[model samples]
Target: MKKIAITGATGFVGTNLEKYLKRSYKVRTLSVRYVHDQIFNITDDIIIHLAGKAHDLKKVSNPQEYYESNFELTKQLFDAFIVSKADVFIFMSTVKAVADKIDGVLTEEDLPNPQTHYGIAKRQAEEYILGKEISKEKRVFIIRPCMIHGPGNKGNLNLLYNVVKKRIPYPLAAFQNERSFLGIDNFNFMILKILENKNIASGVYNFADDEVLSTNELVQIISETLNKKNLSLAIPKSIINGIAKFGDLVKFPLNSETIQKLTENYRVSNQNIKNAIGVDKLPNTAQQGLEQTIKSFSKK
Candidate 1:
């Protein structure tokens, strides 16, 4: 079995990936806080770099933390990988590395214009990897995944699930937006394919589910998962915008950032990656994966 070492192994994605790959690969979790140079000595065939400062929705995190954890640490680990015998290196990046707002569907052809510290840091790490010369025997993959959701996911989706569970009406029904989401199962499958297939080239790839869903559709799915009636209010956009501004001033639950998140269209195209992997479609459809996630939330 190929030996795989993953950073941020205790994180949501890392934990799930480690468990999923353990049966086929010898998976080892590496500490991001440890000596960087020692990464070369881990004796792994593959390294999946998942450690980085996640985007802080509260905006309370120090800006420098993003660079230190995402860029600096990744640079260190990657440098070690270059000299080591590791044949494959997979870096977990984000769609935010390209653009905060999607104009049409996001693709690898688009130039990066990151607006946040977290996105900038990840882009820097990606640039560092791209700038380096790789051995003929080695391959590197930088994946930009959109909003990921699955069992144990905690974030806006969980919050929405709670609101629906409490029978609260979704007030953002007036907003019309479509979003791309990555399911853990599909993501795990992609990683496994990347690890097993040497024919695949090394490059940046966008990862997302086959289908996109609007917020209204998502709310309906959540209600259906709980076997409850869907209740959504189409509040006027202007009214909602005013409330969001007030929320910003008071640091309330529905701030400007949260509002943008709920209403923004962030469609990402996975065509390039899919073509490269020679797959017609991912294992799970967006609705199927989302229903599974919503069911998990109901159980909680």
Candidate 2:
């Protein structure tokens, strides 16, 4: 079995991938709390750099937090990989590295024009990796995945689940936006496939689910999973904006940050990646992947 080393093993995607990869590969995972001893034993293996700082949702803090963890830390890890002579390198980059607000479907051709510091930092790290000339025999794959969702995810999904559990009426149902989200299962399958193939070129690839989903669809699915009626209001976006602004002034939950998240078009196209991989399409459809995720909420 091929040995695999992973950073951010305790995180959402890492833990999920670890569970699946243990079935076939010998896996070594790293944590900041641990020493180099955790990553030292695994030499000449495939390293999946899943560790990085995510975008700050609060919109209040220093931008350095992103660069320190995402760029600087990744540089440290990639340097170690170079000396170790790792066979393959897979870096978990984000679509945000390309744009803060994707006006239309985003493709690989777009030159990165990141908005926030988080995006800027990740883009810098990606450039650093791509600029380097590693061993001719080795392969490198940089993956820019859109909003990823699965059972163990602790981000937006958790908030949606809470809202459903509380039976709060979703107010911003009028906005129709298409957004792409990757299921963890499909991501795992794609990563494993990349590891198995040697002829695949070393370059950047965009990863996402088969189709885009709207917020209304998400709400309906969540309600179905919880076996409850969909309680949502298709109010005007302007009115909702007004309410969000008031909420922001009063220190309420539905502030500007939440409004932006709850209603934004971040649709991404994986056609370029599909063509590069010489594959027809994704392994699972968007509906299938999302249903599986919704069902998992009742597992615990």
Question: Against the true structure, whose TM-score is highest?
Answer: 1
User: Which pairs in model 1 have colliding backbones?
Assistant: none
**Pairs that collide, model 2:** none
lDDT tens digits, residue span 191-226, model 1: 888887899999999999999999899999888889
| TM-score of every candidate | 0.96, 0.91
Best by lDDT: 1
lDDT comparing candidate 1 with the true structure: 0.90
- Candidate 2: TM-score? 0.91
How does candidate 2 score on lDDT? 0.83
Candidate 1: segments with Cα more than 4 A from true spot? 34-40
Show model 2 residue runs off by greater than 4 Å. Answer: 32-42, 59-62
- Candidate 1, residue 133: Cα displacement in angstroms equals 0.6
lDDT over C-alpha atoms for residue 57 of model 2: 72
